[model samples]
Target chain A: MKILVSIKRVVDYQIRPRPAQDGLDVELTNVKMSINPFDENAVEGAVRLKEAGVASEVVVVAVGTAANQDVLRHALAMGADRAILIETPAVVQPLTAAKYLQAIVQREAPDLVLTGKQAIDDDAAETAQMLAGLLNWPQAMFASSIQLADGRATVVREIDGGQETLSLQLPAVISVDLRLNEPRFIKLPALMMAKKKPIETLPAADFSVSAPVLTVLQIAEPPARKPGKILNNVAELVAALRAEKVLP
Target chain B: MSVLVIAELDSHGIKAATRSAICAASQLGEDVHLLVTGNDVAGIALEATKIAGVSKVLHADALAYAHGLAENLAPLLVQLAVNYSALVAAATSFGKNVLPRAAALLDVAMVSEVIQIINATTFVRPMYAGNINATVVAPAGLRILTIRPTVFEAVAATGGAAALETLTATAESGQTTWLSRDLVQLDRPELATARVVISGGRSLGSAEGFKSTLTPLADVLGAAIGATRAAVDAGMAPNDSQVGQTGTVVAPELYMAFGVSGAAQHVGGIKDSKVIVAVNIDADAPIFQVADYGLVADLFTVIPELEAALKAE
Candidate 1:
């Protein structure tokens, strides 16, 4: 079976995000960019499928600017057989991204597609399912474990109360949760080898998908929490709590 | 102006977050319609109808909805979206997953994890891990929103005469099928949907400590146990149990912090709770700012005493 994993280039999760001066969106200048953590899980899951001899080929595909080449390279260094970059400057919404991916899936005709359950930036958590809807494919989102055999896949999803196990047919889309697998780092030697690997670049306009229907009007920073005050002793704190009806 | 509130139900019954969403829906004028889609969810619809101010309850019962997969439910929601001015769902995993897809299908923007309904078209939502609050106005006509359950109080169950209407939908079997379910059946209350939450931070030391010290206290109070991202990263708790900017956002009636030096991310998730009480050795911990009650004492000593006091009560 062939595997295709969707990756996104997002602002580094570690940095403190600040709103732009226009108060319309996050300021991205000088901010470090990396492959979204969830996408990393997806990439890692695809690599595992290859290691387990379940997948014949693993292709890592990313949709973003030319600068996202670094992120696609990272995936290639990890273990993907090849990389595809669909270059676009526009901020693609989940539906638009899903439509574009549907076109890609039609071209590639991969049996399995993997992606992160949600991107940290938008926290939309809908792309994989939306793609599944657009393609009428089965989806196992927030999948903690995946077992493939007999043209069917058994996936364990981490739900709100507990874990739910689902069986899906081949040619399905699965979104990886954090607990699915710990992503591996690329060694310097592997990084050097990745430079020699081939990356196919496709312009977003080449896809028949249209512009996003919804537009982001503005992005603003949340209110800052007030600094805490120190209490002298436990008794005083208890008294204060009782007075405030918190500890009564 | 009618509001459509999506009702969430599990095996246990109606989720508390859905109750909160119902309350939020009540605030948007009087014509509040509750939409329920699931197998054997008639009981859930019956219970939702009891909540005050609910005008109608719509049930789309089908076997395909047994798992409540977003792929299948999004289209059903789009069909219902035409009648209501705004759509509301709880910010639980199910709501977060399906609402966006529904919004996308409707070709409209979604305002997620909303804390307040500013008006018909505008709402207040937290962005950047709750670091910044964004007040947004949805495009005119219809608005799609997901409410953080903790922000609103549950509407009182006054046993209103809510009219129940059954709607049929074409079953779209996706690539997936539910095989089995393994729920971590906790005797204690749920954390995100609980009225009271007692959370421990990295200062608890280890998972053993959390099990020994925090679990007992939580069990006695019938409260949900929560942990900071530090504790989760330290492997003391699973990532799903973590409460922070990236994790679950909860606003229980009462939130108790133990040995937690409230990081901005952690505070952002729980700051909406009605009352906060902090128990930490360091008096200057950032958690005390939002905490209604602050205790400067070692949790090792204070937790046992607090548990005993609660037990005595």
Candidate 2:
């Protein structure tokens, strides 16, 4: 089985991003960036499948500007066989990203596609299912555990209330969730070696880019909550909660 | 223009989040239609018809949709999308799974996790894990959206008497097959819809500590149990019990956190809770910043005392 995993570069999870001065988007000037946490899990899962001899090749893809190559390299350092960066400076929406990925899937002809359940940046969580839809393939979203065998993938998905298992034929997309697996740390040697690995760059213009269906009108900070008070002890806490009528 | 809202269903009937979806759809326009698809969802369809502001209910009953697989449900949604100006659903797991696929098939962009419906084409949603709110405007065509149930108020359940329409089951795509499910049987309310939620973090130590320390308080208050990502990662809580950006975003009346450090990811999920109470040994835990009330103490001792105090009442 050949697995293709998709990743994105986003503001580090540790950073509590504030809106930009124009109130149009988050401040991304000189902030620490990293691979989306869920995508890291996806990469780690795909790598593990290859390490287990179940997957023959693992290819990683990202859709963004050249800066996204950093995330693709990180995936390479984690044991992806090759990397593809679809270069575009435009704000790639989910549908656009899905279209770009569909082109990649058609070219690579991988048996499975792996992606993060949602990106930490947009939190859209749409690309994988959209890709599945466009390709008329099946999708398993929020997969906590995935097992591949006999041209089928059994995925344990995280639903609202509990977990549901789904078995999909090959050429399916699986969006990985947290608790899937801990991403392996990149060693100094692997990082050094990954720096030399060639990444294939494809211009977004090469493929027909559709007009954006949705445009961001504005972005602003949500109203902040009022500063809360600290009680002296648990008794005071209970009294305050009761006074607030939150506790029956 | 009319809006079509997909109903989120459980084993019983229409889920509470679907009611909130209806409320969001009603904001879009007057003609708010609902689609309920499942194996045995006649009762669920009937329940959907009673939701206030809904004008019609489209029920699709088939074994293919029994598990609500996106492969089977998305196509039916595409077939039904032509009549409405927009498609809407609560951003639950089901909605999150099905809507984008349908949107892709329709060749339109989807605005997900919407918190506000500014107009028929514009919406307000959170990005970067709820730190930044972005207002998005879609082109003048069919729009797809998934609204955050926590942000929208659920419409009343017993008001309108909408007409019911049955839809023929879409053919099985044969690309995916339903397997087994392992759902945690909860004695208390589900976390997202619960009136009160009691969450713990890594300091809970082990799965035993979560059960022994938190269950009593949850039982006393009739609250659902929640956990921080650290606690869930530590195996102290199930994956579904995790309350965070990646886990579950909850907006309960009262949210109590024991030993939670409140990382940005976790805080994003709970920021919508009406009253947040945090108890932790560390005085400077980030959770205290967003909490409505804070107490600096060890949770192991405080949980039992708080439970006793509530039980005494």
Candidate 3:
């Protein structure tokens, strides 16, 4: 069995972003970029599956600009056997990304496709399911644990009030959640080896993007959150909460 | 153009979030109908008709949709999409799982986690973990939406007498099979409904620390328990206990945070909380800026002190 992991380069989880002057996007100048934290978990999951001998090979794929390859390289260092970058200059929405990924999936034909439930940037949490729909495959989304067996993948997923386990046929899509795995750091030797790995690139112009679209009208800092004064000790904090009447 | 709202019930019967989704649907300038899919749930559907702004109830009475499995229900929604201009559901796990699939089948984009309905076709939503809010426009076609209910006031559950319409069960999609579920049955107040909430972070170190330190405080205050995504990721809390962009969005009257250095993802979930009190050793933790009362002290040191103070009172 082979596994494909989708990677995305997003604004670092820690950066508090402000809307750009264009009023349609976030300010990118000096903003840090990194592999989406959940995508890192997806990579770790694929690596673990390979290590457990359930997966024959792991391919990391991403759809974005040249800078996104850095994210793919990070995945390669983590353990994916190869990388694919569908080079696109467009701001790929969830539906469009899913379409591009579907194109790649048709070519790769991996037994399982794994990706983050949502990216920190768009936070759509829509791509994997969309890809599953386009591919006509079952999706066990927000998977916390996955096990491969006779032509089936059993996924333990996180839901609102509890956890549910679902079994899907092979060649399905699974979206990784936060508790799926702790992503490992890239080692020095692995970093050197990843540089030598093969990375295939495809131009986005080859595929017509999906329609039924959305347009961002404006993006502004959510009316500034009032910064409360920092109190020195617990006594002051308690006194304040009492004064505010949340506590007696 | 009519709006169809998908409603999910809690063990206690219908929840306020569903009512809020109906309230949101009503604002879209269209006839609002709600879909309730579950086994042996027609009685609940009858009860559901009392919610304000719900003009009709579309009940899919079947065992297959009891769990709201995305496989079986997504197709059902797609088949029913012909009559409706917009399909709306509260941005819970059920909405997250089903709407995207329905939208994909329709070959349309689903505008998700929407906080405000600017008009019929436009919306305001928080992105980049609530640090920035974006106004988005859905083009001409089916408009699919998953409403973030915390931002909308729930309409009254009594007022309207809506007629119940039974929907036929579509051909079952046998692609995925449900196995079992491990549910967290907490007797305490639920995070979304609780007046007071006590949340923890990864700095709690381990599940043992979380249970020992946070549970007592929660028990004493009769507050719900919530966790930052970091704590849930670290296995310090259950997945359902998570509060963030991907987790439970909570806005209790009093939301107390311990050992949580507020990351943007976690902050996104707590914006609705009325009075935020944060206790962290790191004075510069971003949570301090959003908190109403910020204490720069170790959680271990202050939590016990505060617990003692509350107990003495």
Candidate 4:
């Protein structure tokens, strides 16, 4: 089975991003960048599938500028067999990203597609479901566990109340949550090997890229909490909580 | 312009988050219609009709919708999208799962986890795990949105007399099938909507430690229990109990943390709480920055003392 996985380059999850000076968008200039945390899980899942013999090949894809090759290289070091970059300088919204992925899915004809549940940058969590809709493929979102066999994939999904298990036909889309697996650490040997590998590049103009539908009006910091007081004892804390009507 | 609010359900009736979504829908436009779809969910639709701002409730009951699988449910939304100006739902797992597919099928843009409705076209939503809030203007066509439930007050549940409309057409994408469900049955209130929450960190070494340390305090306060991702990762708590950027984002009336270092990811989820109190041995723990009250002490000793004090009172 050929598995295709999508990864995104975003501001590192550890770094707190601030709004730009002009307040039009988040400040991305000179900030630390890394693979989105969940997408790393996606790449890890795909690599594990190949190692387990369920997948014959794993191809990792990203949609960004030349800089996205960094994340592609990171995926390669994790054992993805090939990399493809859909080069675009513009900020690709979820639907437009899905359209690009749809074009790739048609070209690759992979049996399964994997993606991070959501990107930390936008926190939109829309691409995989949108891709599934555009491709007319079944999707299992927020998958915590997955088993592939007999042209069907059984997935355990994390839900609000509990876990729900579903079986989807092969050639489906699966967006993974955090609990799926801890991504393997990239070692020096694999990193060195990945650096030498060539990445296939395709211009975003080649695909049926649609016009942007959403416009950013402004970006600002969320409301801040009031400064708190440090209590010296449990009794003082309890008394203060009661007076504030925070304790019953 | 009419707005369609998708109602989420459990075994009992309409979920609380769906009520909040209805409240958000009412803010967007005057005509608010709710769609309740599931197997034998007519009762839920009837419950929806009683919500103050809802003008109509659409009920679609069928076995194919029992699980509310996105494959089948998205097509149903696609069928209904033409008549509505916007489709709205709570940004819970169910809404996050179903609405995006419907939006894509209709080839429209969606703004998820909306915290404020700036106007009919503009919205405010958090990005980078609540660090930054972005105000976005959606396309002029059909708008798709999911409201962050905790930010909006629920509409009154017993005021309106909305007409119940039964929908017969069913859309089933046969590519996916539901198999089973494993839900953690909690005896206490749900973490998302509880008035108070008591959460712990990895300092509780084991699952046994996690339960013993927090359960009594939770019982005394009548609050729900939650955990940091570190605790869940360490197996001290169940995955469902995780409260962080990657886990359940809660906005309870009061949130209490014990031995939590207050990482950004963890704070991202709890920043919306009305009152936050943290207890930790480390005085400089980051959780104190966002907390309304901070105490430097051993959580093990603090837990017992606090529980006993509340019990005595």
Backbone clash count for every predicted candidate, in the order shown: 7, 0, 0, 0
What would the TM-scores of all predictions be? 0.90, 0.96, 0.94, 0.97
Task: Put down candidate 4 lDDT per residue, B260-285, tens digits, no spaces.
Answer: 99988889899999899999999889
Tens digit of lDDT per residue, candidate 2, span A1-248?
A: 89999998999998989888887778889999999999999999999999999999999999998999899999999999999999998558889999999999999999999999999999999999999999898899999899998999999998877889999998899999977899999999999998888799999999986745677789888888999999888789988888888875
* Candidate 4: tens digits of C-alpha lDDT, residues A27-72: 8899989999999999999999999989999999998888998899
Q: List the residue pairs that clash in candidate 4.
A: none
Q: How close is chain A of candidate 4 to the true chain A, as a TM-score?
A: 0.97
Best prediction by lDDT:
4
Of the candidates shown, which would achieve the greatest TM-score relative to the real structure? 4
Q: Residues B1-313, candidate 2, lDDT per residue (tens digit)?
A: 6899998777767887888998898888669999988998898888888889898999999999898889999889989988989999999889999999999899988899999999988899998778788999988889899999888888998889999999898999999998888777878898988999999998988999788888888988999999988888888888788888888888898999999998998998899988999999999899999998999998887888887787777
Per-prediction interface RMSD?
3.0, 1.4, 2.0, 1.2
Chain B TM-score for all candidates, comma-separated: 0.90, 0.94, 0.90, 0.96
DockQ of prediction 1? 0.41
lDDT by residue (B76-185, candidate 1, tens digit) is 98888888898999888788767866776676667777788866767777765676666777768777778887778877766677898989975675656778887777
Which of candidates 1 and 3 reaches a greater DockQ? 3
Question: Which stretches of model 2 miss by more than 4 angstroms?
Answer: none
Model 3 lDDT per residue over B293-312, tens place: 88888899988888888888
For candidate 2, the per-residue lDDT at A11 reads: 90
Could you give the C-alpha RMSD of every candidate to the true structure, in order shown? 2.9, 1.6, 2.3, 1.4
Tens-place lDDT digits, model 1, residues A1-248: 99999999887877667888988778898999889888999999999999999999999888778988999999999998899888888567677788788888999999999999888777667788778766767778888898999999899988887888889998898998877888997899989998988899999979877733434456776554455446665556556556656543
Candidate 1 contains a number of clashing pairs equal to 7
